[model samples]
Target chain A: MEEVRNQQVILKDYVNGLPKESDMLLKTSSTILLKLPKGSNGVLVKNLYLSCDPYLCCLMSKSQVSHLESFTPGSPIAGLGVAKVVDSGHSNFKKGDLVWGWTGWEEYTIITAPDALFKIQHTDVPLSYYIGILGVHGMTAYYGFHEICAPKKGEYVFVSAASGAVGQLVGQFAKLTGCYVVGTAGTNKKVELLKNKFGFDEAFNYKDEQDIDEALKRYFPEGIDIYFENVGGKMLDAVLLNMKTNGRISVCGMISQYNLNEEEGVRNLSHIIMKRLHMKGFIVGDHFNLYPKYMEMVIPLIKEEKICYIEDIGEGLESAPAALLGLFSGKNVGKQVVVVAHE
Target chain B: MEEVRNQQVILKDYVNGLPKESDMLLKTSSTILLKLPKGSNGVLVKNLYLSCDPYLCCLMSKSQVSHLESFTPGSPIAGLGVAKVVDSGHSNFKKGDLVWGWTGWEEYTIITAPDALFKIQHTDVPLSYYIGILGVHGMTAYYGFHEICAPKKGEYVFVSAASGAVGQLVGQFAKLTGCYVVGTAGTNKKVELLKNKFGFDEAFNYKDEQDIDEALKRYFPEGIDIYFENVGGKMLDAVLLNMKTNGRISVCGMISQYNLNEEEGVRNLSHIIMKRLHMKGFIVGDHFNLYPKYMEMVIPLIKEEKICYIEDIGEGLESAPAALLGLFSGKNVGKQVVVVAHE
Candidate 1:
């Protein structure tokens, strides 16, 4: 086995506020053997599609208290990536197997915990879909909406950051469930994408609205039954006021508050009691067991044109840093992915 | 039957911020007919015990959005009360039948909504107990703890306002479920009552602790699994930080915030997502169907002396204003009830 140059994206240092592109460095000095060592219980993989997730920004932070393992300043930043197994010692994954799991931001990686790697059963669809639409992001939207929010038919649903990787899917899922769905995004383009392309009943650019509460009251006159909360802070405060009795809030992410030095205080939390609301928070990794069921339900829809997924792909590993940081700035139009090596 | 003077507690005006005793005027001008008019559907009752609940303060405000009807100035204040049927046109009640329901804070009155009146089968317990231990306060504690919190054996349970009407019962119920319970109160006496009388595993005086989060850390090193949220300002914020993964919070009341001109902003609600917490707000009034089942479960425990309820009785209707306002100041030692008349 020969050592190959592994071009990687590395965290320059732990980020403070909104992550700058310089916070991540692209390095080519890293090299890895394209073979698993003898008797080593690992799978050596050539990374293909690397997912640019908002949660990766949380990992770039200095906070050690978070459930996600923080990225070391000098280490290669890691995230969910689709890969082709080059060599393997693990029984589940063999050589030439298409898999996706916790892989690095480099061309090649030897996954020490092969348990994290899942074999791709159907390659009938695009393999890169495993990184976004068919991966943790997809599963997150599925479990977070169907399980956490528990949307009923004809219910009023609201999604924040509506055109992002997860939010776009949540809005569509709400529509598929026969719910009256409304979404909020930073830019008019994303808002337009939400209403026009994603089949949302209504969409609003929150930046245009002077008062978020008044905007929500205007859009949701009857009040919101379910809130898919991706961007928390003032938006969450507004949603709390607008929620109807027995409303459910699925706390998928708080991207708006994550970069702030001090998280904004939510003033209308007592409305949860008055309205008899249920607010739950969940992690997709914890609900991975639902993956097979998720695919079974989602694939038929995708194949039949009953559902759609939009991907915004960066060409190479060099673009990974900017693409990943772009999430906080609302730069990516749809599901953000960086294409590394083509199979 | 003849017209009689009804000594009543009337709202001088809608209260602002912390209610002063002067906000409620003791009026003797009110008069009512003791006889039920022919073809009338109402029931006339002699008020025995009037409940001074924390929720009444919310009614004193001018917020029409609240589920509770605001107290109209110059009109008699109304709340949950134990009464004796003097004259009845409603079939559910007859002369001398003891009943309890929504009644005016007065000597005698006509209950327009006779359906709201519940017949008291068990005079075996103290009649005043109907206004405290066996009424909405009891049911709030029961449903809030057993249904919402869904306590599993050996789970860590924390209750704020631990010696108050609802919180004390929640702590006791947690103990019955084999949970390790900790409670927080405003005073050392109340704390002692929680630990010793209520059989909580531990108790703390929140007033004594400068840092509530650190105090909770001291009490629950492994972190809280169930938090019965009664006072929902700073205590709720602190509890959010201390909650374990998949923690459940039953938001029964936010006494601390009800009187504030601008309710305190909860800063750590985002922790709900990071910790995968489930926070639900509920009203016992919505769960009235569970009352009979609750009575069956709780009556036996009360009869066997397995559970205890403490009542802080104000002498008469004149003390009602002070007793109700005392809840916010943490002046009432236990369940605050005003005894208006004797059997």
Candidate 2:
């Protein structure tokens, strides 16, 4: 058997607040074999692209009896990753196949639940897209908007964190559907990307706007029919005032308030009941079965160049921490993916 | 033509805090003639049962902006009321037809848009039920639970303000669907009403429970699958901790935080993204067209005694302000209604 080794990034400890580079440490270790043991159904993979998402910060935090489990300290940090199968014992996956799912933040991984992994059949696009635009983040924007908000052709759609992974895709999808799409970004460059790259009808730099209510009014004069909520808090309160009757809001994330010791108060949520608005929060995994359907629709858009995707790629595992922390600070331009090793 | 005059309940001035009995004054004058004038489509009606909803208190506050329109300081206060058609030039109605919609707080009202009025078809149920269970509150609960939450059988359901107007009906509906249901009320009496009268599996008094998280754990050992949110703030924070993966929260109101100068912060909303949960806020008026469907489901339940309703009735128009303000104080046992003059 070939010599086996895994380069892994482990969580040093449960973080109290925002994670620092010291919280994670990467180490190279030797493995006995790449093959699964007899009678075990698993796949061994050499991980390539790893996703650095905002939610990973929450996973590193101390367990506060949340709805999800905190990532175990000392265990390898796990997230969406694209990898190639070196060896396999599962029926669905064979040796030398490319796959993507919850893989270790490492150069190699032994995934037991190989069923969760999706085999890459289409190689027409960049393989790294599997960790982002064609993966969970892409499906997230698609299902959250199409399924949750049920956007109409002429609806007014607003997305917060508009330059991020899911928000960027949501804005694009809205524009393609003939929506009057507006988005809020943290910086002018991201705002420009929203309008020029993502094709959003209007874009605003929330940081520059003195008043969020005034900002929303300038973007949505007739009122917002759909709000793709990613950054919550004052943004949500302002959006509530600008919502028309029968508005729909898809809650994907609240990145702004996540790390705060005390959460921000939202004063205008009562408008949901008054204006008859519908605001729903969702996750991509719950709607994973629709991935195939999402691919069917999105693949063509990418092929035809009707849809454009921007990704801020960190060169190696060493830069993963900075890349992840950048999400909170709005530093990443688009879908943030860490390149562990080039294919 | 009858002698032309208008008796009205004028808002003396916008209130600052909890509205007092003196904040609103009922002024009497001669009855206005029921005439369409030369070319008007307006219908004239003699006001009957008027709805006393919690939202009216917000309109009374000077600091709050009324969502629809501010009640003119020197003019009559208006709300959803049932009225008897005295004369009509509008196409939909004629003299003697009973109707319900927005009407002024007076003996007689000159309604500009008769189209907003819904004709009374099922007078079999109490006409006041039209303002409570069969009206906005009822439809609110129905669409909020059925459409928003999309609850499944055997799911664990929790409702706040359990014995209040909309909460009572939501709990009953969950029970009917074979779900495990629990509720929170402000008083021991209302808690008892939730368990015995509303058929909730478990009920607690929020006032008695110092630690809401502990209280939620006692009722939901496996965690909550659905939360019908009425009382926002601390209760919402606690419920967020107790929500299951993919939990659905239908935000109907936040009675606890509404009157506050600053709304309370919800620390556990981050759970929304981590748990892949859905928290939706909706208004009843947005789903008004579902009234026929709601009535079809609710009317039979009422007739079969499967649904139980409670209303704290005030005697006349003069008592309307006190009845409405009672909602914030937890004084109203169930739906609060004002009996101006029952047909």
Retained true contacts (fraction), each candidate: 0.78, 0.57
Question: For model 1, what is the C-alpha lDDT against the true structure?
Answer: 0.89
lDDT of 2 by residue, B252-318 (tens): 8888876677767666666776676776676677668888988888898888888899988888887
Off by over 4 Å in 1: none
Of all true interface contacts, what fraction is found in model 2?
A: 0.57
Every model: Cα RMSD to truth: 1.2, 3.1
- lDDT score for candidate 2 against the true structure: 0.84
DockQ (C-alpha based) per candidate is 0.78, 0.49
Candidate 1 DockQ score?
0.78
Kindly list the per-residue Cα lDDT of model 1 for residues B1-343, writing each as its tens digit.
Answer: 6888889999899887777888889997878888988888899899999988888888888873467889899888899999999998888889999998899999998888899888999989999877767888899999999999889999999999999989889999999999999999998999989988999999998888999999999999999999999888889989999999999999988888887888788878778888999999987889999989989998899999999999998998888889988888889998988999987
The deviation in Å at residue A56 for candidate 1 is 1.2
